[model samples]
Target: MLRSFTKYLFAPALALAATATTLVVAAAPADAAVVSVRVKGSLAARTGAANWFGKTRTIKNKQKVTVTCRVSGQYLRGNVRKTAQWDRTLIGDYISHAYVSGNPKLPVCAPPAPAPVAAVPMGPTGTMTNEQFLAAAIGPAQQSQRDTKVPASVTLAQAILESGWGRSSLSANDNNFFGMKCFNNAPGSYAAGCKSYSTQECTAQGACTTTVATFRTYRGSVDSFRDHGANLKSLSRYAAAFNYTNNPNQFIAEVHKGGYATDPQYTTKVVNLMAKYNLYQYDLKV
Candidate 1:
C-alpha cells in the first residue's frame, strides 16, 4: 500500500538552512528597487510514487540579495507554497529538512519508499487463527503505547470499518471499500448511488430521510487501499499523521481526528473492531 519516493540530498549543516543567513540585493535599473536575494540551499527534484508536487531551488547562505518581500505564488504548488497562513507553520516543519545552513554544494538525492509505520500481524494462512492476528496486532500498540500517530494498521482499520469486513453491499458488489462518492449529478447507475432502506440522508429542511446514498465503486480492495493512502498523503491535514506512521493506533486516531469518518464513535469503534479481530497486530512492523 506504500509508494516509493526519492531520498532528499543533504549537505553539511553549514551548507543547509540550519542557521539564518543575510539577504543580498542585486542592482536593477533606476525604476526598480534593488531586488533582494537571500542565501539558502537549493533543493533537488523529488521522486516518489506518491503524488507530492515539489521542486528544487537554491537559497544563498550569508549572501545578501534584495527582492520584493510581497511576492506570492513564487514557490511551487503542493510544496508548502499553497498552504493557508495557519497551515504554513505545520507544513514548514516537515519540509525544513530539505534546506541547508551554509549553502554547501549538495546534489539531489532521490526520495526513498516510505517504511511501514507498523507491522501487520499475520499467521500461517492455513492454520492461522484469529487469536494469532489479535496477538500480532497488539504487539505494536504495546511497544508504543500511544494513539496520536498514523500507522499502517490504522489505514487497514479504516477500510474494515467502511467496508464491514468486505461484507457490505458496496464491498461485495462494487469493491468500494472506502465508500467514496461522486458529485450529486454524476452519470451512470451511480447517479442515485445504491441507496439502503435504513440509511439516512439529509434534506434541505434539515430533516433526515431514510435514503442511504450510493457509495462509489472501485476495481478491487487493493485499489481502495492505494487510493486511500494517496488521498491521505495529498492533503495537508494528514501531514502530521505521516510522522506517526510507526504507530497504527495513533495513526488511526489521527485519521479520525482528521475527520476520516462521519461516525460519532469512529475512533472507538475502529479500536474495538481491531481488538476484536486482533487487527492491531498488523501494525507492529517497521
Candidate 2:
C-alpha cells in the first residue's frame, strides 16, 4: 500500500509541474504588432525628430503608413494643439502626431521632451511710429473717404492695423491694404495681379490657425485705396457699415458688428487708433 501511494504521489507531482509551466507561459506577455493607420492632413515625414529643418517628404492625407513605434518630439501646434508624441514610420522616418490621429494603444518608447514654446511673432507691427504710419496712409484714407461713403478716419485706422503700417508684405508688395482676398480665389483680378499667401485667422472660439489664401494686388497705393471703397460697395451685406459714414467711430462699430472682420475687438482697435492719432480730423473733411 505504501509503494502504491508513492507511485500516485509522482503522478500528482507531474500534474502540478505541468500546471505551473502553463501559468508561467500565460504570464509572459506576447509582443504587440506594429500599429499602422491612415494619417490625416499633409503630414511631413522628416529626416529626424525636429521640424525646424523641414520635411524630407510630405505624406498625403489619408495615406497608409506603418507606425512602427512612438517617441516624444517637438511641440507642433497648428489646426489642433498637436501632440509632442512622434510616430515612427516603417521606413524609420518621423511625423508629428498632430497630423496623424489614430490609435491610442500605440507604444510610447520614451517620454516627450517638448520644445520650448515660441513667442508669437510681432510680425509687421511696431516697425514704425504712429506718426510715420499716419503720414504714409492719410492721403489714401482721405481719398477713399471722398470717393466712397466710407469714413476717412475709419479707413486709415483699418489700413494701419491691417497692413501693420505698410510693413506687411501684402501692403508693401501687393499693395493690399484691406487684406482683400483674390478674385475667384485666384490671382489676376486687378491691375497689379495677386499673390497666394498664408493667412492666419482667429476663430470664434479664439483658436488661431493658418490657411493658404490669395490676396488682390494693386498698381499703386492709391489704387489700393480705390479698391477698398469698391470692395465695400460691392458687398451688399456690408451696406449697413456705410450707414454712419459721417461718424467714423459709429461707422467702424457698425462694420465690426456687421462681421467685417473675425476679430472681436476690431471696432475697438480702429476706434482707439483713430483717437490715438487724432485721425478724427480726416472724418471732418467728409
Candidate 3:
C-alpha cells in the first residue's frame, strides 16, 4: 500500500511538468521575418529613428536593404508613402518607411524612454550699463554671426535698440531682446514658450498702432540672440541679408527692407547704434 501511494504522487508531479512546458511553448511568439525591400529614392539611414539623428549612411535609389523591425518617428512624405514609421536595418540603422518601395509589416521596436529637457544656462542679473550690456552680448553675437552669417554688429545694435539696452520688460522678463513674436504661438526649437505683451507696431508709412502681441520666450539672453539670427536666416524675405554678411550696414538695410520691424527708421536706428558702439569689430570677416 505504501509503494502504491508513492507511485501515484510521482505520476501527478510528472504530468504537471509536462503541462507547464506545453503552456510555455504556446505563449511564445513566432520570430519576426526579415524582409528585403528596395529604396524608392536616395535615402539617408540615420543612427536613430528620427532624421535629427546623425546620418550613418546613404541608401541609393533601388538599393536593397534587409529590415528587421519598424518604429514610429518624424513624419515624412516620400515617393512611395507618407508616414512617420521608420524601419530598422539588420545593421542597426534607421531609414524612413515612407521611402521603402513596398509596405512590409514587421515587429514594432521597443520604445525608448523619454529624453530629459536640456538645462538652460542663467543669464545676467539686474540692470546693466551700456558697456556692461555690450560686454555680455559680444560673445553670443559673434557666435551667432559665425553660425548664421548674420553680422555680429547688426545683432548687437538691434539688441541695444530693440530691448532699450536690456531695460525693456521683454528683455528683463523673457530674455527676448529682439521682440520676436510667436506667430500663432507655433512651436520652435529655440523658444521656451510664448508670452503676451502690449506692443506698438508701426507701418512703413509711419502709421503706429498699439496692440497686444505674443512673443517668444528664451531660457537666457544667449538663446534669445541665437534665435534672432536663426529666425532671420530661416525667412525667405531675409535671404538677401545673408549675402551682405561681411557688410553690417548693407545687411541691416536688407533686414529692414524685409519688414523685420514696422518702424520706418528701424534700419537707421540700428546702423547708428552700430557706428556709435563700433560693434562691427566683433563681426566675423567673411
Candidate 4:
C-alpha cells in the first residue's frame, strides 16, 4: 500500500510539561543545527522520511521535540500546516513538519552520496559485455532458484532479455530488471515504490502499442531478481512452471503459456537466449 499521508486529528492538547527530555540526534552532521518545535497534535514519528517506514513512536500534543534537520518527503497536511517537509528528530525519527507548531528554520539534510559504480569489462561498442552481465547475474539467479525453486537459467535468461543486458533505463536506473509492473504497492512487499515509464506492449495477436505504465521499483538488482522469483512462485498462473524447475526451457515455456508476457514469441526469445548463452548450466537441481 502506498504510505498514507492522511493526518489524524486528535483530542485537544492536555496540560503537560512544555518540553520533553533532550534526545541525541543521529545521522546529522556534527555542524548541523538543531531546533525544537512543539507538536501541534498527536502524531506518529516514523523511522524513515516516508510514512511507509515503521513507526518509531507517537508524540503527543504540546510535546517539544528536538529536530536536527529537514528533508522533503511524503506530502502531509496536519493541524499546523501542510507540507512535504519532514523533520529529522534528535532521536533519529522523522516527523511531518505539518504537525509541528514552531517555525524554526532547519538545515536541509545532506543528500546521500551516490553508490560507487563498479567498473565492468565493456564490449567493443562500449557496453557491458554479455559475458560480464552473465557473470554478475549468476549469483542472484542461483540464489533465486534456491529461494523459489525457479530455474536459475530461466531467471538469468529473463534478465538478459527483459533488461537488454542491463542497458534498459529501467534496469540501469531503477534496478527493475524484469519490467515488473506494479499491480499493488503493498507495504513490506518487494516493491519499495512505483515509477512511471513509457513501454511497448504487445497483444496476443501480435498487435503492439506504446503506452505509459507504472512499474515496480527495487532498492537494488538483487531485490529485483528475488522479487521475480517470488512473483512466479506466488502466482497461480505460473505454478506449472515450478513443476519443471530442473528444466529451464520447459519452465520458461510454461511461464510464457501462463501469460507472463503478451508477446507470442516471449518464450522462444527467452529460450533462444538461454540456449545461445548456455544459460542452462546455471540451473540448480530441484
Off by over 4 Å in 4: 1-127, 185-188
Predicted candidate 3 versus true structure: per-residue lDDT over 1-286, tens digit per residue: 9999866754654453231110000111236457776654456789998878999987776667777788888886554456899888899999777555546567897676799975443433228988888888888887788889898899989998889989999998988999999987873778899999999999768999999999998888888888999999999999999888888899999999998998999898999998988888888885
Compared with the true structure, all predictions reach lDDT values of 0.44, 0.67, 0.78, 0.77
Give the distance in Å from residue 217's predicted Cα in candidate 2 to where it truly belongs.
Answer: 1.3
Scored by Cα lDDT, where does model 4 land?
Answer: 0.77
Worst 10 residues of 3 by lDDT: 19-28
Candidate 1 lDDT by residue in tens digits, 169-284: 77666655566654463523323243332354444354655655645555444444445556666668777677777765666677667766555567787877767766666564
The candidate, 2 or 4, that scores higher on TM-score is: 4
Highest lDDT, which number? 3
Candidate 1 accuracy as lDDT:
0.44
TM-score of each: 0.40, 0.52, 0.57, 0.55
After superposition, candidate 2 runs with Cα above 4 Å error: 1-130, 186-191
Query: lDDT-based ranking, best first?
Result: 3, 4, 2, 1
Residue pairs clashing in model 2 are: none
**How much does candidate 3 score in TM-score?**
0.57
lDDT of 4 at 271: 90
How many Å off is the CA of 206 in candidate 4?
Answer: 0.5
Among the numbered candidates, top TM-score falls to 3
